[model samples]
Target: MKKAVILLSGGLDSTTCMGIAQNEGYELYPISFDYKQRHRKELEAAKKIAEYYNVKEHRIISLDNVGGSALTDKNIDVPEYKGDGEIPVTYVPARNILFLSYALGYAEVIGAEAIFIGVSSVDYSGYPDCRPEFIEAFQKVVDVGTAAGVKGKSIKIIAPLINLSKAETIKLGTKYGVPYHLTTSCYNGKEKACGVCDSCVLRLKGFAEAGIEDPIEYEK
Candidate 1:
């Protein structure tokens, strides 16, 4: 079987990507980051999701805790959902860039054919990195920067949920039997989701729109 490295954050979207990639017949190599963020719940969720898929190896990369983002820094509190189009405080500086770089290196080493990220342009917080333009630019970087790319065999960077709305993504994941119960989308990182942070709010809205009950508990 072919191999694919999935950027699994143990959230709703990334877990969906696991289902999608598994359905696509790739041997899963899920990669996660342990960047000393405020919450450890997502990391724990990632591990559970990986085990659910029975992946041979799950890499949790330890990254130095970078400040400037509410998600990573304890000083910056995670804000409640604001539907304004402006990028939120939760936007981590150069997060996806750094993550995909590490994933690229891992894919090259493991000879994986694709890297899966579950970033949606629709129904999301206004993070610049979650947009299609960023994915396209990163794909260009992968196309030109990697040795495998120069050799005419580039690892594909797949964002299966880029164009889909949150509801649509939830529907897709449901079809693939993704274990949504094991996922986490609470930016606050508490065991019980705050249900107010942008992450939790979006997830709740998605499930509501999808006409499915969110399996996780919330501290509303």
Candidate 2:
């Protein structure tokens, strides 16, 4: 059986990726982060998703250092952008890099051949880590940073949604039986999704494009 580690963020995309991994018959080990982000409910949502799928294991790691970035800091506001070139205040510095490194480390420990991430380019333009080049660069880094790679074994970074639009991702998730209702994508740590945040906006747009009514309620 091919084992894999999925970086699940409890968002629409990552939850979809979990379904994708299960569909591909990979024994899944889902990993979530408790990186002091403003929206901590997503971590709880991630646990629910894992239980729904019966993932082999679920791990949560903390990214300490509440310095800079709107996510970790309580003062900085998470800007609701007008969908332009700005990266926004919600960009956590080196977050993806930290998460990927931990995923790689866990993958090496368990001899997992691949690590799956849910990053996409079509819907998320603000995050640089979601780009294909970033994944490619990280793949190279993983190759050099591990004993498995040193022994000529490949550690592939599997990003099944890198090229797909958020709408297409939703379609795929639906096909794969992903429980969209179990996911959370809000940047605010609230009972319902604060629909104004970039994450919420993109998620709502995706559901709209997919022609499926989102199951979760949003605070408009």
Candidate 3:
């Protein structure tokens, strides 16, 4: 069986990516991060998702000291649905870069062929790290920095939802039988999703556009 590392955030997209990776016949190694975000809900959700998939290895790394963005710093507020064009304060500084770096290291250590991240340029918060250009650049970094890459084996960074809108991603995930109810997409990190926040808004919007009601509970 082929091995693949997935950066699973226990959120909508990353959970969907898990389904995608499984569909591709890769042995799943899902990794989540605890960056001292506002709430532990996401990490909790990640744990549940990993359990549901029955993955062999589910590693949760701590980045509590690496605080800067609104998600990691309580001083910064997680803003509500602002227009989607501007980069929000919630953008964790170099988050994806750090995440992919971790995933790359794990992949190399485990001899995995690919690392999957659920980053979509379309229908995403305007985080610069979520863009296609950044993913492309990170792929280069993986190619050059890893010992495997230098030794003629290159680890692939796969973003299956890069070009898809949130709605499209939801549709694809549904086709793959992804258990969306186990996922959380709230930046507020509440027990029930704070539906007004950017993350929740986009997720709700995607479900609406897909003509399917979201299975998760939301704060009224």
TM-score each candidate. 0.99, 0.96, 0.97
Q: RMSD for all candidates, in order, please.
A: 0.6, 1.1, 1.0
lDDT of 2 by residue, 45-144 (tens): 9999999999778999887865688778889987774698778788888888999999999998998989999999888847888899999999998888
lDDT (Cα, 0-100) at 115 in candidate 1: 99
Greater-TM-score candidate between 1 and 3: 1
Best by TM-score: 1
- 96-115, model 3: which lDDT tens digit per residue? 89899998999989999999
Clashing pairs in 3: none
Q: So what's the TM-score on candidate 1?
A: 0.99
Backbone clash pairs for candidate 1 read: none
Local distance difference test, per candidate?
0.95, 0.88, 0.91
> Best lDDT goes to which candidate?
1
> Which ten contiguous residues of candidate 2 have the minimum total lDDT?
63-72
The whole-model C-alpha lDDT of candidate 2 against the native structure comes to: 0.88
| Candidate 2 segments whose C-alpha is farther than 4 A from its true place | none
